[model samples]
Target: MSKQYTPREMLEKLISFNTVSERSNLDLIHFVEDYLAGWGVGSILVPDETGKKASLHARIGPETDGGTVLSAHTDVVPVEGQNWSRDPFTAWEADGRLYGRGSADMKGFAATILAKVPDILKANLRKPVHIALSYDEEVGCFGAGPLVQDILSKGPRPDLVIVGEPTNMKVVTGHKGIAVLKTTIRGHPVHSSQLHRGVSAISAAAKLITWLDGKTAENRAGADPECPFEPPYTTLHSGTITGGQAHNITAQHCEFATDIRLLPEEDAESWIRDYRTFIETDVLPDMLAISQDCRIDVAELAYVPGLQEETDGEAEMLVRRLTGDNARNVVVYATEGGIFQHHGLSTVVCGPGSIDQAHQADEFIELVELDKCASFLDDLLEGMSQIDS
Candidate 1:
């Protein structure tokens, strides 16, 4: 807790907590809350309705908004299957890098912001530097809404928001949206001998999968002819599929899930509408002919919006000034930046480390990247101070 503690130390402290998306981030939240309290800052904790998780919002300057929000997620993705050289939480530093689960994926940025708090406090500020951290961001950006909603409903709107998703020290203003879906196939079971008479959900599900894959391919090919990305198109992919029992017998049930990575202009609901239309127009009628009870159901698992700022948007200008970057980049990954923009705050993504290292085995952030981020924060805080003064 000494002034000599660098952002990396604070990051190491943060990474030590196992705040997986499935677990409560309360411990991490409280730890951060206490840290800010020691620095004479007050925070608000919006605990989940079930009391399992919470999001923390703290301020170093004026409590009334209208300055900036430094936001990052508290939860890290699961590391169950990945092989690691060391404990994912212990935060080992070597080869000029900090290795840990959330090291690069996030916590590092939080630490950078934390390390600068003393400087921010010392500066003559006219506006607040709101520090907002949320849980379940990896799950779907769900936990941030309520916390941000409360902030919006209570006070002045922030001038800008910086979403600290790893971007290799570059200012990224745009990213693709993501949608997850789980589908169910329902039909009547019948005797194995009665192949034609029975409504085979397995067969219907295969047809649906084929149709979906085709739709995905069509969308990918036809979408955004002026694609800015490497693939430059929407991506649809099935993750899990299962059905049927006996080889000779007609199976009654099948279910599966898919993920849709959409372009900025693409609305996830549009994809849903098209899919439902396909199921009704092409799928249901044929199955209904065999049995009246035959049905297909689709459910949305999660939807993360795209951060599609216009060319040289307000967000772009703000980030450009902060990072001194003249070029903007777009990413395929989804982050809370999109959510923040949707909620009315001008948002931009710019942080430390390569996302390639994110959510992987031996995930780590290079010391050079952290140094760059710290320098970024230094300039940002100084800029805010000058404006506030």
Candidate 2:
């Protein structure tokens, strides 16, 4: 018989694996694959090109259509700069909370699903329950696209996908989309005394960053008061910036990264086009005037589509019925739920823990949150068993 673990134990085991976004998650993936195999559940591994990382998916119960997909990502953010009291990868319980990296962000919910496997098997579900553990979700949701394709190609279409993304167990019907971009400016280097003769890459970068901030201010000013999002507006932000060799010299190179979060109703391409146009028409011309080699380049790092609210979405109704949470909610962060919904699968974001605790120094999920998530899964298993296929 496969060893049965409580949700807490599963969480501890998962936390032990340092599946940071920058590192390979294969060790954690292999562990999960073996655990699922112990339960006689076979997993399909979708490995990335490097073969160092992979996403795992498995089905419990009948291999029929209209199943529910419990989706969670295995990767967590880096803990390098955080002031953690203990090892971020070591799970510890204190003050009714489970502390560790990835605890609240997602691993808590993933642990709950794994711990419930025995009950899921016993439920003899009429409808299948799909478990989808994805990789690279923190950095860019890069793994989810391929995982979703693999799942849809292999089996009958899933009826709904519930993305466990630390929503305090509340059902989230929509979230903002994100477009990650990197901008690099190349300029002719010259002494600051002769600044007028050569373009300063750093100065150009500052102008572009100011433009991005201005765009954000414009959106904030025009934000919809009735919008469910906290800020209720699109946002543009520059997370990192690097360039300039010295104070006395006009910089030869400047580089920065920015991300734009758009409402589900907005078009991402339009924003990209607008930003590119600003660089080419408004910014780049001045640099080229100084030197023919002077240029600005903008590259897209990643793009995650927003989760749009579905009218009477089945996923929403099912989650509300299970958790009895009727409050309509939307989040500002992006999730793989958007990708699932984009591929014609009805999806919602609902999971244990608060997003506030995610990506923090002492990240934790309240013990009660884990219990509530377990109960939610229990209710789902019972319902799946009782419902007709």
TM-score of each: 0.95, 0.97
| Global lDDT of model 2 | 0.94
Residue lDDT tens for model 1, 319-338: 78777787758898899888
lDDT of 2 by residue, 1-389 (tens): 67899999999999999999999999999999999999999999999999999999999988789889999999999999889999999999999999999999999999999999989988978889999999999999999999999999999778999999999999899999999999999988999999999889999999999999999999999989999997899999999999989999999999999999989988888988999899889989888887999998899999999999999999999999998899889989999999999999999999999999999998999999999999999999888886545
- Which parts of model 2 are misplaced by more than 4 Å? 387-389
lDDT of each: 0.84, 0.94
Steric clash pairs (candidate 1): 126-388
Top candidate when judged by TM-score against the true structure: 2
Clashes of 1: 1
User: Number of clashing pairs, model 2?
Assistant: 0
Off by over 4 Å in 1: 1-4, 63-65, 387-389
